[model samples]
Target: RFPRNVQLCVLSFLLPSDLAAFASTCKRLVSLCRRDQRLWFSMCHRRWGSQTLINKWGSGRISYRRLYRILDEYKNLIGFWRRCGDSAAPASSSPPPVFFEWGPSYIAGSRVFPSKNKGYDAMIEKPFLWMSVAWNRKAMNYLDSDGKFVLNEEDLIGESGFVENELIRVNVGKNKITYN
Candidate 1:
């Protein structure tokens, strides 16, 4: 049998579902899988180490396992996204495409606009949405209309059809987007 450290290293490589299944095999493994900080922290670091500061997330108040769940749930959103249907904003105020990025303590969506320069094909990013864990460990999403990180309580509907006061929910499917 491998030593505890080695076993934990191996367990760190497993998906959460697989680890849960393995943990059910015996009392020893169940205890190890449930209480080992290194295993869960390693799992988070391995997946998102380069994109974000894993340790700084949740302000050291939440467990790494919970943090892992939060990151995994929203990981697919870390890229450019364009609305597929009719415009959600007024015709006179057509909105630009948006890009999502990772942050030390949150995931932010920003408005992307073409550069004003004559020939430089660069895009500019303006902060639009900020998503982080709340005091209750729930997802807290805020929309900043002025891109100034100000938390406005007014119910503002963004170009993405998302409301400032509502939780941003997405239903991803294997072949198409579906919801339950």
Candidate 2:
């Protein structure tokens, strides 16, 4: 095994999934990855893109792992919602509670195709974090890097608002999403 610095440099090239798999193979690798915030930061910058971190996270002292996890959660949740359908529509002409199965979702180029995933139900059980939206109308897209969220205009606006490039910030906790 190389020194910690060399280990970190080597580990930096691994994707999050690859890193996790490598870390699981031994305690030394796990400790090296977890204890060094710089490694995680490098991973964050690599996966999410640098400007994305600057725009969304700024220079604040935030955990890279936490940021990555929350972003993953958002992607999963949006995928679930998109698959479930018509978020603006009422649950059944009545309101009490509504629930549905999970779905698959993906972004290809600038477009997002909605589908189903059974794992969505699991997302609801996780704690709420925070979300940020970068609304780009000319490009017709909505983005949240931390939550791994991206929605095209049709999914979010449904042909109504004057689409413009703007950033919307919201905090999701205490069972609510509040603008900041």
Candidate 3:
């Protein structure tokens, strides 16, 4: 990036396609390459424009120019992560905070009595995951059936045996919190 015509500099020094091969050739190179975002970016971005490369270059998106850009971004030597496959598991950039929430009804031994509790309406019951992806640091949290902040309310209820979740609800005159 220092030299104005530096675009041409990488060609003589490091070709894009050769970078991955070079990175694999030795440990030092791999370490350098890992720090170099150009290779990783190319590897990642290559998946994006496959059709364009085939139409124009008749090959992959690999090129020397992109490699230098990656080097510039990664040369400082910081952390890098490479995903081997589709990572479906939940991931967070930062460790989650120590959290405690209500335990589930199964652990609480409080079953919604359905028709037995005619005073209440058990019209519909289905489970869905509501996440608090908008936490203080933009993290994910889940909301339970009653639209509470905590996904599991068992901890909030403690060992007290409440038959229905609404019984403990702070709203609608159900604030009868009692512990077993």
Candidate 4:
């Protein structure tokens, strides 16, 4: 077996999925590569170029491995959401009215306003990098940066008026497509 430094240097070039698979190969490698603080820090830095955000998320004694797992899991979920349907066609037979909130960069909700386009064309115009797009027949929900579905919550103990989503739209387009 190579030294710890060599293993870390090699693992730095691997994607998170590849590194996960490598760890499964043996127990010793798992203990070595998975827990290497420097290796995980490097991976996180390479994946996201913001050290301040990383430090904040990694606060409260959270290890770099755990932070990486959280970010990787979110990315995997988005990938799965994207691959669930064909993008060539519209995500649904009819586009549902989408909500775009311009606020402190942490709110998710859909609002119905008059559109300039005729006949009420439905599309999600701009999606922040930290948000996820999901939809059901009744509504399209954009999850927050923490991967939680954003919605207004009324005071409990009475009939809460929030509706749970029945299905997630698989073919939501990231941006509008204008054919020539």
Query: Against the true structure, what is each candidate's TM-score?
Result: 0.75, 0.40, 0.19, 0.39
Report the C-alpha lDDT of model 2 over 1-180, residue by residue, as the tens digit.
568778877887887789889999999778777767878766666755533442234223346666555445444443222224456767654322222211111122122222346454432222122233222211112233243343343543322121223324344443444555
lDDT of 1 at 171: 37
- Candidate 2 Cα lDDT to native: 0.44
Which scores higher on TM-score, 1 or 3? 1
Ranking of all candidate structures by their TM-score, best first: 1, 2, 4, 3
Please give the distance, in angstroms, between residue 89's alpha carbon in candidate 2 and its true position after superposition.
8.1
- For residues 92-132, write the lDDT of model 4, one tens digit per residue: 64333444332221122342334566556743333322222
Global lDDT scores for all candidate models? 0.72, 0.44, 0.32, 0.46
**Per-residue lDDT of model 3, residues 50-116, tens digit only:** 3222111201233424433432332232222233334566565332222221122111111122354
Model 1: weakest 10-residue lDDT segment is: 153-162
Error of 3 at 22 (Å): 4.5
User: Model 2, stretches more than 4 Å misplaced?
Assistant: 54-59, 74-130, 133-180
Cα lDDT tens digits for candidate 1, 93-169: 77677798887667877889888984578877887666666435765555564565543333323332235344434
Error of 3 at 2 (Å): 17
Clashing residue pairs found in predicted model 2 = 71-146, 71-147, 102-117, 103-116, 103-117, 104-115, 104-116, 104-117
